[model samples]
Target: MNRRTLLTAAATGVAAASLPSMAAASPAMTVKDTMNRTALYRSSARTQLAALRWGSTTARGLLEQVLAHQAEVNPGVNALATLDVAGARAAANRADQYLARTGRTLGPLHGLPMTVKDALETAGLRTTCGSPDLADHVPGKDADVIALLRQAGAVIVGKSNVPPLCQDLQTSNPIFGTTSNPFSPAHTAGGSSGGPAAAVATGMSALEVGSDLAGSLRLPAAYCGVYALRTSRGSSPIVPTRGHIPRPPGWLTSSDMLTLGPIARDADDLDLLLDVLAAPAPADRRAWRIDLPEPVSRTLDGQRIGVWADDAYCRVDTSTRDVLEQVTREVRAAGAVLDESSRPVDFAASNILFQKLMYATSAATAPDAVFQGEVKAADAVTEDSPSALYLKSRTMRHRDWAKADEERQKLRAAWDAYFETHDLLITPAAPTAAVPDQSSVPAPERYITVDGVRRSFYDQTSWINLASPVGLPSLVMPAGKTRDGLPLAIQIIGPYLADRSVIAAAKALAKLLPTPPKAPGLMA
Candidate 1:
C-alpha cells in the first residue's frame, strides 16, 4: 500500500489488528490502567531493547504494544497527528529477523518504538509544521536527528502535533487541531513540542525527539511531567534547521537560538538518547570530532548549586514557589552548598536582549510582503518605544542584528563567569503550571491566570527564554505537583558543554521528590 493509504488505515484504527500478537499472551497491564499511573510508561526504551536482545519479547510485539497504546488513548488527547503503523511494523519485523539470524542487537536503541514531532521532516511521512499551507507536504528525506535515531534502531511510528510553524505557546494548528493535556483535556499540553510531551507522558509513545526555541521542549515537558534536555547550542553536529519548517523546504538556516533534543519519561532515558544524538553529522565525520566532558560531580554533596526560583521580572505562582522552597530544603539537607543570593546578569536586560535576538532571527522566515509591511509599520514608532520592539526586531538591518549579537555575547560571558563558582542553577520552568487550553484564541490575545492575577499569554515563556539566548544546557524534570494535581517542574541550567552535569543534577533531584500522579480520567 502507499504511504497515504497506510496512514489512513492507522488513523481509522483499522491497522491495530495488523500488529503481531504477543508471544506469551499472558495478562498484562491494560493501556487504560497504565495511563492512570504516575510511573514511567509500561516499558521504557531501555527495557524494550533489553527484552529484544534477551528474546523475552520480539520487536514486533513491542511495536504492537506501542501502537495499541496509541490507539487506545490518542482519541481523547489528539497528541498524535499521523500514524505510520505499516511502515513501523515492517521495520520491527526486519529487526526481529536480523536478531534471530545474527544473535546480536542492532544498536543502543534496538527495537524501540518512538515518535517525532510533526514539525520535523520524516522520510515518507507528512510533516505539516501545524500549517495548512504544508498540510499535505511529505519529505523524501529524514531530518539529521531522525537519521541518527534510525541508525540506533528506533522504529519510527508517527508524528505528533504542534502549533502553527511552532510559533505559539500552546499546541494547535489548522491541520491536526489542538493537543490537550493528557492529565486534563481542559488544559493545554504546551507547545510547540506539546504533542510529543503528552504522548510520552501517557504511554502513547516510549520516547520523543523535539525541537526547542523559547522553551518549546522544556515547557511542554514541564507541563506533562516528563524529562527534557535542551541541548547546548551547536554541541551536536546535526543541523536542526535543515528539516525543520518555518525555514521552508531546502532552506539552509534556522533560528539562532533553536535546538533539537530528546523528551522522555525519566533522566536516564534522556541520557540514553543524548549519547546517540551527540555525534557529528555525516559531513563532519572526516575531521571534526566532539568529546563532551563528564559532569562535574555525581553526588549533591559539596556541589555549589544556585537557586533562582522567583525573580522580580517574573513571579511564579504560590504552588510553584512552594515546590522550589521544598526542593531547596532537601538539597541543603543532602549536604549540597546552596546559594540563593548570586544571580548571573540582570533578568530584565537579558530578557529584553533575548526577545530582540529571537524576533530578529525569526524574520528570515517571513514572506517578502509581510517583511516589507512590518518594516513600514516599525518606521512609524520611536526607536525607544517598547511597543515597537517586536516590529523593529523583525525588520532590523544587518547592522542592528550585529549589535544585538554583541549584547548576547556579553550575556553569555557573564553566565560563563557565574558558572565558574556554581555547578548548576535551579529555577522555575514557567510562572505557572499548564493553564487551560487557549488554542481557540489568537496567540496575542490569549491570557493566563497566575495566583488569581491575569497575565499576558506570553508570560509563560518569559523564564524559559533566559537559557535560550545564552546557549546554556538546560534540563526540566518534574519537581512536584500543584494542589490541583498539575505537574510542577524546575529547570536545571549548567555551564556550556556541561550537558551531562545538568542531567546528573536532575537525576539527583528526582530522587528527592514524590512520584508524580497520573493524569485523571484514565481507567485504573
Candidate 2:
C-alpha cells in the first residue's frame, strides 16, 4: 500500500500482555520431597507437567502447590490484579474428579493454572480493564477465551495487572499499585502485561494471557526474561461477553488489529495454552470466531527462517543486539540455516508503514495525544487531498470506517507475500533493557545510551508491529541476561495463522540458549 493510503486506512491500535501453575508428583513435576521441592520451582509449564507424570504425582496437588507459591510470592512482585483462590481450587478439584470418573482428560491444560490480563473479563472477577474508572466493576460472564480455557480444564488463577487503560508500557494503576521487574526493582516491567511477565519470570504462575497492540505482550516478555506469543489477529476467540470494551451506541468494540495470546517460559506450553484459548466459541460468539490452521512443522528439517535484527529507523540496543547475535549464531549452529548478513530486509519501509498505522492505534487508545499527532502530521502534507473519513475517524466519526479498512487489507497482503518465503522472522523484542521505574516515558523518549545517541523507545514496538497489522503470529523467548544482569530476548514473527510455527521455533531456540535465570528473592 502507498504511504498515504496506508495512513488513510488506519485510525487504529491494540492490548495486556500475560500470568501461572503448581507441583504434581507425576511426570511434569520436579519437586524435591526431601527439601519440600518437587522439580517445580522455576520449571517450564511443559516441563513441570512432564515431571509430574514422571513422578506419578496428582494434578490436584500440583495445582495447589502452584497456587500456594503464587500467593506466597505475589506480596513482593505485585502481579495479580485479582486472584480467585476458592474458585480456582474448586475448578482444580473438579478437574481431578473428572479425570478419576470419566478417565478422560479435558485437554492439555487439565488442572494447569493460568492468569489472564484484567482487560479480559472473567465472570465474577473485577474486570478493571486496567483503568481506575472501572476498578470495582465486576463481570457477570466470562470472556469467550476465558470460557474456552475453563472448558479445557485450566484454572483461572487470577487477573493480571496492566497500566491504567493499558495505554503505556509501565504496569501501574491506582487500584492495584505497580509491578516491578524481578531483575531490577528500579526498572519498569514492560506493560501492560508487565504483571503477568513478572509473575511468570518469578515462577509465580505457569502461563499467562496478555494482549498486544504495539508491544504490550512482547515488551514485557523481553523485559522480564519470559516467552510471549501474539497470535494472528482474530485467530483466537475473543468473545466480549463480559465486556472488555464497554462501547456506546456507535463506537467500536476493541481494536481488530490486536489479539490475545499466551505467555509462558516454554514454547510447548504456549502451544498448549493456545489450543485452549484459540478454539471456536459457542454459537452466539461466532462473529469473532476464527479458524486457526494447524502448526506448520511436524519436524524441524524444512523449517525456513528469515532473521532480521536491525534497521535504519531504530538501532537495536547493545544488549538487545548482543542477544540477537547470539540467537543467530546459535540457530545457525543448530540445524537451521541463516538467511544472510546482518541487514534487516526492508525494515525501514516496514517501520514507516507501521508508524502511521501505529499512531492510528494510539489515537483511539490515548485519544488526545495520538489523534492530535495525526491531525498535526496530516497538516504537514499541505498539497494533497486527504479523506475526511480518515480525519473524522481520527477525531469525530466512528462508523463508515470502510476506507481505512481497505488500506489495512493491502498492508496485510504485502505482509502475507513477505511471509510466504519464510517460515518465521527473528528480531529483537525491545530496543533496550528495562527502563527505570517512576519516570514518565514520553512517547518520543528514546533509549539513550552512554554514547549520547538517541533511539526511539517506540521503536521497541517495531518487531511486533510486523506481526500486529497483518495479524501475523510472533513468539518471544528469553535468550540470556546482559552484562549488568538485565534480560534479553528475541521475537520470532511467523506467517498469518502460523502461531504454532512461531512457538515451535521459539522452543527450538530456547533449548540451544541459556535457561532464564530465577529472579533474585523472587523464585527459590
Weakest ten-residue segment in model 1 by summed lDDT: 16-25
Model 2, 103-222: lDDT tens per residue?
776677777767778887778877786677787777777777787777777777678878876777788877778888888888889888898888888776788888777788888988
* CA lDDT for candidate 1: 0.82
Alpha-carbon shift of residue 301 in model 1 (angstroms): 0.9
Each prediction's TM-score versus the true structure: 0.93, 0.80
lDDT of each: 0.82, 0.67
Candidate 1: pairs in clash = none
- Evaluated against the true structure, the overall lDDT of model 2 is 0.67
How does candidate 2 fare on TM-score? 0.80
